[model samples]
Target: VDIEVVQETGSTNADLMSRLPLLQRPVLRVAVHQTAGRGRAGRPWLTVPGGMLTFSLAWHLPQAPQNLLGLPLAIGVALAECLNTLNQNVQLKWPNDILRDGKKLAGILLESAAASEGGTWIVAGIGLNLQVSDELEAQVGRALADAPWLAQMDRNLLLAQLLNALASALQQFAGHGFSAFLPRWNALHAYANQSVHILDHGQILHAGIALGVDLLGCLVLQTEQGQVNVLAGDVSLRPA
Candidate 1:
């Protein structure tokens, strides 16, 4: 994999997407500052120079997988698993949010584009809070978790470990879809067996206990109507 270190970029995901036509192998873009970073549901990603570490990795496959929706969840599992060993407090929020001590620590965004060379290209963008600064918390208007360990650690070694974990997960996903990661994802679920609410556009859709996820990687909620499988989209999950 080729690594491109940039002091700043408008958006690493967009940068890698534009380079997909010329892509032949995996590529990783590390941006110290993203002037126009974006999160899931088109939310603006707030960042401060030296206070956060943001990067996006691009991988190409000959074809798209059957369970494409599960890709982000699988990545979440991989991230939580990788960080859990170093910091037991690391947890995974459904879909693709990485939490620490019950607070948001990192967000993952996965975007895919068709390659001109006849394949599929995926760019996984990650934004992680490196320091719990008052300014950052104020900008987000929410409590956030910081990875002080990551702040003090060598970035190169940290990147190597994260990338390796991602590589292994992606390789496994390519072979088995999401069934292989369902159990792992549930094991690290931040809201496992907890009362949760499924919402769409701020309207409650279902209120129930999170029963982890099914084999197909859909969120299984134990509601009064019995088990309900929720698909990922603009839907949001929160504590009830």
Candidate 2:
């Protein structure tokens, strides 16, 4: 894997995606200051220099996965596992949100493109709030969460651990799909077996009990209607 750090960028994901055709092996790009980061649904992602960790990993796959939907969830599991080793109880929200004590500590965004020679190229972008500041909170318009132990840890060391975990997880996923990670992911699921709301486009789609994820990594919600397999949507364990 190759790693590069930049003082600032518009978006690490965009930077790597533009170079996908030239990349042969896995590469990691870290941005100390991301000026135009984005989240799910085109929501703006604000980061404070030196207070957040923002990076993107570009990996080439031999072929597209049978299902691409689970990739983000697998990445979330990898991140949660890496953070948990730091003595922090990190949990995963469906799709790719990382939470600690029910507050979002991090988020993930994935983009892919077809390789010119063959197969698919993937870019996984991650943003983690290491030490939230008043400025960040004000910019985000809410109270944000951070890893308390980051104050005592070196950023480079932590980044290395996360990259290692991600590499291992990606290898496993390539071989066995999300089935290999379903058990571990469920164990860390923040709302397992809890009543939750499934929303799409700001409309309530289902109100049901969270049944955890399936082998394909879809959220299985047991609603009064039936067991609904949600491939992608917004889920809230609490009433919205």
Candidate 3:
């Protein structure tokens, strides 16, 4: 595991993706601040220096899975598992959001590219709000959430734990796919078995009862018409 910490960067995901061709092994890149952070659907992710955990890990996969769609959900499960050990009781919003008490505590972004020689390289980026300042809350126009224990824990220690958990989870996923993690992920799903609204591009797509996720990690929604498997895309889910 190669690790690099920089004072600032545009986006750790972008940086790692750009270097994947030359990377001989997995690399973890952490930045003190990200000037241009990104989120799902090209949304901007804002961060304050020293107040958030922003990092990316680049790993090479010898053979890409047939369905790479579940990778982000797998990563979310890894994060929840790590945070649960710290007694945070974190929950996962479908696909990749991490929540604490139903509020956003962290987010994940995954990007992959074909390797120069062979195989595929994936970059997984995570942004966790350790402490939400008043200014940040105001900028976001809402109260954001953080892991309370982060104030007492050393950043490096927390990072180490997260990486360890992630490595283990990734290994399992590579070997067995997302099936092994389905049950655990559903147990931690924030909207499991609840009536929820699914939106795509700001328009209502479906209102249905959450039936957890399928083997492929797609959200299975029991709608009036039928059961719909919702894939992660330009979509959002909220309580109905």
lDDT values, one for every candidate: 0.87, 0.86, 0.89
- Over the stretch 1-240, how does candidate 1's per-residue lDDT look in tens digits? 998999988889889988888887899999888998998878899887777788999988787887688998898888878888777889888878999988999999999988777668899998888877788789888899998888888887777788889889999999989988988888888999999998899999889999898766678999999999998787888898
Judged by lDDT relative to the true structure, which candidate is superior, 1 or 3? 3
On the 0 to 100 scale, the lDDT of residue 168 in model 1 is 95
lDDT of 2 by residue, 1-240 (tens): 788999999999989999999997889999988999988767788877777789999998988889888889899999899999886779988878898987789999998999998899999999998888888889888778877686468879988898889888898889888887889999999898888887777578888898899887788899999999887744433432
Error of 3 at 186 (Å): 0.2
Q: How close is every model to the real structure, measured as TM-score?
A: 0.95, 0.93, 0.96
Q: CA lDDT of 220 in candidate 3?
A: 100
Clashes of each: 0, 0, 0
Question: RMSD, model 1, all Cα superposed?
Answer: 1.3
Stretches > 4 Å off in candidate 2: 233-240
Note the residue pairs that clash in candidate 1.
none
